[model samples]
Target: MKVNELFKEELKVINMGLRSFADDVKSQDVPVLHVDWRPVAGGNKKLSSLLSKLKSK
Candidate 1:
């Protein structure tokens, strides 16, 4: 597909980790898929690394 084709299509957004952003985008009447995402271990780097290692195995 060409870059111009993307501009012709309707705008859609996948807002992750921030509901406020999704709400802001929705105010413009655009399609949005809001994902209430967060870090695996509350943004704890060491624990997240350990969990990632476990998941890989």
Candidate 2:
């Protein structure tokens, strides 16, 4: 298995947090999976604590 063989498949990217970067990659015709990301609980300590407790169930 040569390194060149690995590149035979089409390039793909998973863009997190920034949509503009993903859009730029798409401009080059490459496929991109965009994930909208934000700070957990919007930077609220209380809300984040509550959410974490809920997930423990």
Candidate 3:
């Protein structure tokens, strides 16, 4: 094959890859909300015991 043909094929592959990546980025560009909890000072023994019991079961 000629070098020009090979180069064109590589460019096509790269263009396709870039388009796919751009589509993915655009799809995930929305803001997201997350929830989390923090333990109180010294922690709650009742909550800790419940968690341990749930894990064992």
lDDT (Cα, tens digit) per residue for candidate 3, span 1-57: 688786665332112223555455446753322323346334788878888788899
Q: List the pairs of residues colliding in candidate 1.
A: none
| Cα distance off (Å), candidate 1, residue 42 | 2.6
Report the lDDT tens digits of candidate 1 across residue range 1-57. 677997999988999976999999999999999997888899999999999999999
> Best to worst by lDDT, what's the order?
1, 2, 3
State each model's C-alpha RMSD to the native. 2.6, 4.2, 15.5
Candidate 2 Cα outliers beyond 4 Å, as residue runs:
1-6, 45-57
What ranges in model 3 sit over 4 Å off? 1-42
Better of 1 and 2 by lDDT: 1
lDDT of each: 0.92, 0.90, 0.51
Highest TM-score among the candidates is held by which one?
1
**Residue-level lDDT for 45 in candidate 1:** 98
TM-score winner between candidates 1 and 2 = 1
Clashes of each: 0, 0, 0
TM-score of 2: 0.54
What TM-score does candidate 3 reach?
0.27
Give the winner by lDDT. Answer: 1
Better-scoring candidate (TM-score), 2 or 3: 2
